[model samples]
Target: MTSTTDIKAIIRRHRTRDAAFAVLGMVCLLVCIATLMALLVDLAIDGVGRLSPGFLTSFPSRFPGKAGILSAWVGTILVMLVTALAAVPLGVAAGIYLEEYARKNWLTTIIEINIANLAGVPSIVYGLMALGLFVYQFHLGQSILTAGLTLALLILPIVIIATRESIRAIPGSIREAAYALGATKWQAIKHHVLPYSTGGILTGVIIGLSRAIGESAPLITIGALTFIAFLPPAPVQRTFPFVNFDWLASPFTVMPIQLFNWVSRPQQAFHLNAAAAGLVLMAMTLAMNGIAIYVRYHSRKRIKW
Candidate 1:
């Protein structure tokens, strides 16, 4: 009878503790939501009125009223295009080689450790490295190409890590089954592994690109221009048979650089402009993350394994 009473007391204590933890978790989630809500509200109230067509189409000016995100946004798109092109293939390939092909050797272990360590390095360090390699050695000269390469280096570890984790999550049985079917290693990876892992790969890609979009430190470290009023020339010329690569070498400014310019200014108007730009940047990041979530959800749903 005493033991039964003790068991009941223990159950009561556990239930009480669980209930307290549940409430605490809810409180923490609510606080986070509340904070996000407050920020969005502040941004909307301060900047929503400024999101006009003219604001999207005009260039930066000495006067805040005339300043727009035209050059900034355009430069951002061009640089990101370069980064995605350069990083995605290399990152995915490296991940595949490490997870699928590499043996349990010391060199493989060293490479894995180095990649993990690289992921933690500051973005500014990548910028300095780019400043030496791309800017000085390669003589890319603070162009869009240089910035893209720098951002690519900054996010490569992230992509590789994400891809490796995604690939590792697949069951070993799947690989064995592929081998039993007389499939070569390359065929197995191409047909079975890649199809199943595409969702995860894309999720990683979007996440990396999102990070690339918001990075200011690396770009600034490589001497990205802060004040720019003119647009880079079009990638295509108006003349006959005209496809141009010249814009890749042109001077550029990204949105974050422009935002920094605004926030650093003494004028009240530029501060408002900064708020608007912040909203735009936040929207771009959220859009990419949303896409990643959707891809991951569908991928998990389709592949029960």
Candidate 2:
């Protein structure tokens, strides 16, 4: 009877501890959400008045009232385009080679460890590296291409890690089934592995791009101008072939640099401009994440297992 009473006491204690932990987790989550909400509210309050069509279309000016993100946003888009073009394919290919084709060995193990470590390296390190390798050694100039490639290098590890993790999540049975059907390794991977992993891969890509979009350190190190009044040459042309690549070699500045420039000014109006730019940057990030969510949902729905 005494032993039974002791067991009951232990059960009650365990339940109480579990309840306490649950409450603690809830409080932490609420704290995070509340903090984020407060920041969004503050940004909105300070910047909403600046969000007009004219603000979107005008160029940066010495006067606060005339300054806009036209060049900044355009440069950002062009830089991101180059970044995506350079990083996505190479990162995905490297990931597939490592995860699917590489033999299990010490070298592979070392490579994996280094890749993971690279993902955690500081953004400034990449900036410094690019400054030497791209600007000095390769003579890529302080152009859009240099900035894009620099950001691509920054995010390559992230894409590779994400791709490997996504590919690893697929069940072995799927690959086995494909092999059992007399499919070659490449065919099986192309048909079974890739389709299932597309959502996760895209999520990683978007996440990398999101990070790339906000990065100013690498671009600045590579000589991104803080003040620019002109846009890059148009990527589209009226002539034959109808597409142009001259913009890739043009000078540029991104939104983060523009915001940094504004925030550094002594005028109160520029501070408001900075806040508005921050809101736009946040919106762009959220939009990219939203697309990732939508794609992931559909991809998961389409694939049962």
Per-residue alpha-carbon lDDT of candidate 1 for residues 223-277, written as tens digits (9 for 90 to 100): 9999888888898888976888888999999989989989999998998888888
TM-score of 1: 0.89
For 1-305, candidate 2 gives per-residue lDDT tens digits of: 56988999999999999999999999999999999999999889988889888888999999898889999999999999999999999999999999899999999999999998988899988999999999999998899999999999999998999899999999989999999999999999999999899999999999899989999988888888998999998999999989999998899999999999999999999998999999999999899888888877887788777
Task: Give each model a TM-score.
Answer: 0.89, 0.90
Candidate 2 positional error at 210, Å? 1.2
Residue 249 displacement in candidate 1 (angstroms): 0.7
Q: Candidate 1, 266: how far from true, in Å?
A: 1.1
Compared with the true structure, all predictions reach lDDT values of 0.92, 0.92
